[model samples]
Each structure stands twice: as C-alpha cells, then as structure tokens.
Target: MKSYRIIKSPTEGFYKEKGSKFLGFAYHVNSLEDVKNKIELLKKEYYDARHHCYAHLINDGNQKLIRANDDGEPNHSAGDPILGQIRSFDLTNTLVVVVRYFGGTKLGVSGLIHAYKTAAEDALSKAEIEVIQIKQSFVVEYGYEKTNDVLRIINDFGVEINNQEFLAACTLFGRIEPEKYEALKDKLNLVHVKVSKT
Candidate 1:
C-alpha cells in the first residue's frame, strides 16, 4: 500500500498498420519537468513525424499528476488509448509516447486507437517494472555512545541511509516509509536518538 510501480529504464516499441509506422517509447519520470524534458527530446528526435502523442503520470505514490496529449490525431483516438495502457499496467511516474509516421493510408478513429494502444503496450512490455516504497527523509542525531543503539534501531526499521557523519556527535540522513515513521520514533526514543523530518 505504501509502494508503487514504475519503469526501471527507458524502452522502445513498435507497431505497424497498413503503411503507417508507430514508434512507442517508455520512460520513468520524476517530476513534471522531467516529463516535459523527455517529450521535448522525443519531439526533437522525430521532428518530421506526423504526430507525437503521449500520456504521463508524475509523482508516483503521492500526488499523481497525469496528462495525455493527442497532438494532431483525431479526438480521443491517440492519447486516450495510450493512457489506458499505462493505467492497465498500474504504472506510476511513467510516460508513454507514440510517434506516428504516416504511410499513405488513413487509420480511422478505431484503427488509430488500436494502433496507439498496441504501441504503448509493446513499449511497456519491454520495460522492467520496479516497485518503490513511498518514503520520507529524516535526520537522526545521536551521541557517540549511542551510535550502536541508533544503528541497530534504524537497521531494524529498514531505513536507508543517505548520509552519515560520526564526529563528536553522530548524524544520519535517511529515508523511511511514512507508515513506519511513528513506530520508528517510538523505538528510537528508547535509544535516545533525536529524529526529525527533513
């Protein structure tokens, strides 16, 4: 419940109908800016393509921001279908783009939807899906003598350390699931570790 799935790496897919070629791309995006950058890169790469339709979901496991663009395609023919595939896969923080290279033949609304859907599905199928826990950063500070106790407690809670300094005082920057934050506080209290949200 405190986790979500996203693509681990960028991937590509292809679908063809009549003479038209559909090239699909998948990526894991971290923010709205990331989504824009990716789409801009693709548009630059396929500047001459007929249309570049895309769908994206940003901020996985938190506030979800989603968008679908049909570009020049007919209404609901391209973007919606691609979005449907992303939803079907239960993916978050992901973006799927399909570049269209017109082939002499025209794909009606139905045909376009099918083509876009299949292309998006192909790209997703090729990607490696990874699950990430929804977590928040916390700073834990403790005295030198309580280092062992603090380490043991954090380790027991599966908190991932991001930074640490063992000077006169021991300070650790880490990420832990929000659901476990309260329990972590309780356990760390016993060890006298000072913990605060980052």
Candidate 2:
C-alpha cells in the first residue's frame, strides 16, 4: 500500500473574488483532529468571510474514510467539489479548506464547482508533495577517520542521519529504508562499520 505525507504548515492563501468566483487553498494534513483544528484556526483568521468550507480523507492500511462540509454555501456546490479534488489527486490523510468572501455577485452551481476545483489545483501547484514510507532506525559506529566516508555511504543508501555524537570515535544515529536492511548491512560491512538496529 502507498503512504502519504502532510504539508508542513503556513502555506495558504485566497484569490481575489471575481463576482463570487471561488478563491481558496488546499492543504495537506496529518490527522482528522489536525484537520478540524486547522479549519477552526482559519475560521478565526478569516472571520468575515462569507463561507469556510472543507473536506478531508483519512486512510489507514486497510480502511479509508472521508468527511466534508459546505460551511454555508449551497448543499453540494462547495464541499463536494473540494472533496472531488482530493479524490482526483489520489490523496489520503489530507485536508483542504476553501474560504470565500462573497463578491456581491452569485456564482451558480457550475461556477461554484469550477471555482473550488481551480482553488485546489492552484494550492497543489505550489505544494511540495512527497511519498511517505515506513523506516527503521539504526546506530552506526566507525573510526573518526571514516566519518566522511560513512556519511557518503549513508547518503548513497538514501538514509537520514538523525543524530550524531562526536567522541574519540564518531557514532551516528540514523534511519534507513526498512526494505533495504540487508543491503545496507552488507554495505556497512565493507567499511568495517558496526550497524546496530535500533
């Protein structure tokens, strides 16, 4: 199964309202509670906006669920379109909130749909998306002289150095791809480094 990553935070905005044209941002979120919390915060941030709508998808390995709300717009115009965007992107464990400041003009159902979709696409364009994976942590110990070489090897293996302790001997606490455990162990063997699974 595929895993997903959430956007870090603070990347959100709205477009100018053109005769009630849709303007909003889509955000990636980690949990259902986080989604609700973000919506509440945005509500306070845009307190005067006419509507604040949202949608979210949460997926675990075997089961998936979705939730959405129109916030004040017509029953299906705002929220459904935003949810559709989530589905279209094949995203999970994410949330998107669209805040609208009415422009003294009304956009019909179709117009509302287009606006929401465009808003989501615009936000997604500016987002940096990544694939999430399960990883394992390890501790690597080697001679001080091999520090640079060990770093190079770790980078080549697509692992991350979580922490480093510098003593007479350099010790690295790191994380590596779970699936590449054997390969990483073999590579460390060539450098005479000791790797302990954490």
Candidate 2: pairs in clash: none
Best by TM-score: 1
lDDT of each residue in 1-198, candidate 2, tens digit only: 435665544345455546664456666666677787888888898888888888888875556768878887778887898888777767677788888878887777777777877776666556666678667789999998888888888988988878998888989998877778789888888889999898
Clashes of 2: 0
- List where candidate 2 sits over 4 angstroms from the true fold: 8-10, 60-62, 134-198
Q: What is the lDDT of residue 61 in candidate 2?
A: 51
Best by lDDT: 1
Candidate 2: TM-score?
A: 0.63
Q: Candidate 2, which ten residues in sequence have the lowest lDDT sum?
A: 8-17
Q: Residue 62 lDDT in model 2?
A: 52
Each model's lDDT comes to 0.92, 0.77
RMSD, one per candidate, in order: 1.9, 5.1
